[model samples]
Target: MSATPATPGTPDLPALPVLQADCSNCFALCCVALPFAKSSDFAVNKAAGTPCKNLQQDFRCGIHTRLRDKGFQGCTVFDCFGAGQQVSQVTFGGQDWRGHPGTAGAMYEVFPVMRQLHELLFYVSEALALPAAAPVHADLRRALAETTEWTAADADALTTLDVGALRGRINTLLLRASELARAKAPARKKNHRGADLMGARLAGADLRGAGFRGAYLIAADLSGADLRLADLIGADLRDTDLRGADLRDAIFLTQAQLNAARGDAKTKIPPTLARPAHWSA
Candidate 1:
């Protein structure tokens, strides 16, 4: 498919270095661990833990060049944050899951979890990149280092992790990071607690770790905002623009919240979230 020119009026946000797709070290985990159905995003149906028919022995998508035309648009948007390689090389000691039947199931389980951790790292790293987040740079750096360490752990450690507990701990740091970053931006005088900010323009604004419980943020423009470790419980986020916004370790943010949001190909939702139906439209 031809590249689509970026439309004007859409916020021109800073590109995040942490979210870059690195395929060289990956083992095509998304093509194997995740399942898909024939839809606007995929050309055929696939099952969980089943390798994609188009995935080559070397772990590359055989249909990479024609993914969009073949209805695999979702694959094109997925980024594993280098977890695929980390799992394949470091965690599993360079074992090919397919070749070694003994490690296959463990590899499948670890892939998704590592993807989640790496995705979290992606957001945390992005928050660290923002100049407005200088106040929390030290904490961000610590969190980045800690998360990176987790990413490099052995397969057994990764497999046995209490993922929910790990996520909770990470969330605490992210909230503080967000608050410190948002404090640097020029904004209104009133506190934004529980504010209804649906469809609001918050591009490039520092909103680190803001308490957004039950807030209305439908279609809000959040590109380049620092949302690391923010409390987003019960927030309404329909049609929100989250490209370049760091949502790593954000507390109480759910797939349902994101499903209600109007996101696009560039919007980076949590790994727990399925692609919203409205996105590919």
Candidate 2:
């Protein structure tokens, strides 16, 4: 997460200080709770509940700076969206698994649940920030409050939460928000929702106001494309070349998605998102 704070919020909507991952305040839950397969992105297979060998006693990655070079490129793309720290510090009261083995199982189970809730918080908070989405602001606020309440629930309630149903409800409001925001763009928007455009040669395409929601753009050559006002919620951007692409004001495009793709210094992104450090300068 960027050091810069999010935009100020109103009485109905609160600023999102906890939406960004703070690994230092976490107990390395992701390294242990999540399973990974041995692939081009990972050097070895890891099962759920097993700590990564690189996780230090202080809960820091031993090769944090060299993850990509060490064939752990998948780690670089993952952002828990503050779920790690929230579960470690707030949910478990800072009781680490090593220190309290009794809570380990429950803590691990709740971490992923909390992660989904935090992700929803991130999207709703971003939607609230958009001035054009004011028409649905009331619904967004209610969704935000309900989601926030869930994050504060106990381990049992969190683990059993019907997150899919909650996501379905929130997604409706998000779609409405996207429609309102995209209408402000001065271009004929293209709807590529859920389209499989993998490895497509689309460099320098005039994609302004395009709807890429849930689109599979893996390995697509989107360099120098105009994606302003594009709705990129849930888009698979792995290995997508976004070098010099203009994504300013792109709706629901998260930092995790930007981290998953390839880019350069010339890639224009939304102000709220930080430029990936791995991107060429």
Candidate 3:
């Protein structure tokens, strides 16, 4: 799908509402707070806390329209989950890093922290959207609310947080959410342990209550498949397309595993598997 121009003040757009990349209300936070290695995805190596040379006076990407062509595919894929806006508008009260140069370093520190919290909220919100994860919806909702509150905190409070530890706790909750979402799929009748099913097409197939323990499913197309109540312990799920698959009640699905899997809006994952913020139409 082609990218659509965002109408000012229009709530609906092709991209996820919660995942919009708002640079206007930001301090070029991602450019400064995140490090990028020299690769096909980025033009050059940039250290953390250093602003990208391409950042404009207004905190916008100078080559925004040609980021991908300019070897900035990584930048195109990074999403702040609205953290940029929340920090710029709420936490710092619309203050720019330039206006208060003294706070520049501190603002840079807070940006990454806010990004982490916002990313957690993104996953929690996705989990709540699945009707099949009702068993753990309450926990997911509470986590989402708490993470949202953290994103709105003052820069000082956010700068001092043990972000890694907080991320670990949030990851645990997301792991539980994935299990709940997968459990909703229909139960498989038989076990398929350690099967190599790479690139196998199983769209709209019913594998309910089936045991898929330690299966090699690399590049498998399982779109629109019903995987309810299946046991998926230790499965190699890299590059699997899960769009439209019903994974409610699936067991042993981990965040790392889902992270390795490819999915889109139509692909329903456990709340623990936060939607990749960079995904767009």
Q: Write the per-residue lDDT of candidate 3 for residues 160-252, one digit (tens) a residue.
A: 888898777766666565665555544436667789899999889888867676799988998888776676766877667887887754565
In model 3, the Cα lDDT at residue 145 comes to 57
Better of 2 and 3 by TM-score: 2
RMSD of candidate 1 to the truth, in angstroms, is 10.9
- lDDT values, one for every candidate: 0.67, 0.90, 0.69
Better of 1 and 3 by lDDT: 3
Question: Sorted on lDDT, highest at the top, how do the candidates line up?
Answer: 2, 3, 1
Score residue 67 of candidate 2 by CA lDDT: 97
Once superposed on the true structure, which residue ranges of model 1 sit more than 4 Å away at CA? 1-20, 130-138, 189-281
Best by the TM-score measure = 2
Per-residue lDDT tens digits for candidate 2, residues 28-133, read 9999999999997789999999999999998899999999999999999999999999999989988999999999999989999999999999998888777888
Tell me the lDDT of model 1 at 225: 73
- Model 1, span 1-281: residue lDDT tens: 11221221224322222333467766677788889998766789999999999999888889888876777766765556667777777788877877787988888899888877876765565455445556655665566666667777777888887777866776666656556555643543224567979789998776655678668887799877767546575476755787666676555466546654555666555564566665643
Alpha-carbon RMSD, each predicted model: 10.9, 3.7, 9.2
